[model samples]
Target: MLSMREFWNIVSISLCVQAQISQQLSDTGHTWNYDDGENDWSKNYPFCGGTHQSPIDIYSNIKYDAALTPIQVVGYDSPGIDHFTLSNDGHSVKVSLPATMYISSLKHKYTAVQLHLHWGDQKRPQGSEHTFNDRRFAAELHILHYNSDKYVDSQTATAKEDGLAVLGILLEVGSFNPTFENIQKYLSQVAYKDQEVQIPAFSIRNLLPVTLNEYYRYNGSLTTPPCYPSVLWTVFRQPVKISQEQLFSLETALFSSNVGDSIPQPMVNNFRQKQERAKRELLASFKEDFTFPIAIAFILGIFVIVAIIIYIIRKRRARQQSESRKRVMYAAAQKAEGTSSIEI
Candidate 1:
């Protein structure tokens, strides 16, 4: 019953709506490992080519700033966070946290939002996004926070400078980290993208190192696409240790494709390459002095050398005493033989 013009108008409107929907879906379901012509994210995300990109290689020659305040995290051990959600977003596994936890060190208090991880396979081992002295870790964890004082929410804050603060903790393979057990136990539930499970929350502070004072601070953009240059990054110098078993779960337990997909792909090596550090200063909280481990090793080496010298001296003294006793016995025998010959 409609005229030709009306029909064309409706068709155009429908086409526009479909295009918008497709764009949204593409943004949401972006994957890291894509070989198709659609893999180039710079075309889709213009900010990927921005100057202030992240995941930079931190060098040991960073300037030590004594004025850098020690990070103070409040409510990280709160009992209110009894439950949380963990999800597999195809790229990485993310754990959602309540806004109750916040950092008080910065000028404006930043509230905690969520944390995620980046990892690599067993063959490569090192998958952390940020590196220290060109050295990468087995995995990296990022706890994202937003300036709650000025921004109403994290979404709004992501586009502004001095908006988000990310705490980066590197993970090394060593001992079993019980702090990670809660999320690891439920990783299977979220093996595929868009899958999520509820996990009992524990002390988030347990995940951080004992000393939060020493770290590398820089201003950079998000490592992911739409790389917003708003994050104030604080990567700790010390890395936390996790068992090989835990690393295996992180590498092999998750699938990038959906459960119903024709081909199953494991989600590993989700980290971005190190970007150029263009006109940025990497500030360290503490000066690079003799490390505790190095000092301990030096002391142990000294003790071993002293122990060897004492043992050699004692052996020499024992040999000399034995020779002196033999000489005295020989002289006594000779005097007795001479006396017997005289009596004869």
Candidate 2:
């Protein structure tokens, strides 16, 4: 029983909110899961595939080069105010319009618009992607970053071929992650549909396992619908352990709305269908020239900082030497003057 103006106002607001969904523009090419009779859940989602889905099973015996030494990855304390903005619904976190992103493997200089997670039953028989000596974690973290150059338009951008990179971190249950606890602490504030808690310092660095040297690499598509085939998949070989109890906490917290009062579904094996090799090379830690690319970047960033420090030290030393020389010359001049006076 509302007037036309009132209805239009509400509609306008919804559209405005929807307009902020994607923060980046990407190619139009998309991928989807070929319908399988397994789960009614993934029916129409673009990324779910029977033969080319994500969360592939990774065997350790695959040939690879020696593992690379661990390198430090710096993260921005704050991604941006708009990027992590919370939505009205408490269930989903939304990244504001225009998914800005940076890819370290492609050179650390993109901005991630947003990210989401995918999980499954209490235990998966097939195992998760990039397994740890054949071990599988309960769930995984997919952090979606868009190419800044490609994500120039917020309104019309899809995570297409021109711009997308996803960081996949495997989650095993063991001791509780303080970070997860922090996110959980804020869950009650927005745990319904699409609400989000803007978390600063939520860097990929902190989310990663202690060791980044050992991992699996491949080219894959986003596991979700509108399955963009532009992901540079980097699945860590190491599975970060989380206790069964801890795993349940995340499952319950993240998907409270998706499941119908299931007492926080146990996330035992929520991985995607394995995709075909598709002539793709699965790179393991002990396989590629791991150290060179990282070493070079590390050296470059360190060189700039170190060079400044060295220059400061050299200047200070030169100043001290100059003062010492001046003092010695003054003393000699005074001594000669005294000797001349004595002679006179």
Q: 174-266 in candidate 1: lDDT tens per residue?
A: 999999887788999999988998888888898998889989999998888667677999999899999999999999999888889989888
Model 1 alpha-carbon drift over 4 Å, by segment = 1-39, 290-344
State the lDDT of candidate 2 residue by residue for 1-344, as single tens digits.
98999987785454334323322211333222223233532344423343334556675345674543343343433343333454323223333323323455454335565555455454343234444544555766666666556556422334344355566787766787775554445655555554455644354445667777776766676664434455666776666655676555545555434334555423233345555565566776656455999999999999999999999999999999999999999999999999999999
- The 10-residue segment of model 1 with minimum total lDDT is 30-39
C-alpha lDDT (0 to 100) for residue 199 of candidate 2:
47
User: lDDT of each prediction vs. the true structure?
Assistant: 0.85, 0.53
TM-score of each: 0.76, 0.56
Best by lDDT: 1
Tell me the lDDT of model 1 at 56: 96
Q: What lDDT would candidate 1 get against the real structure?
A: 0.85
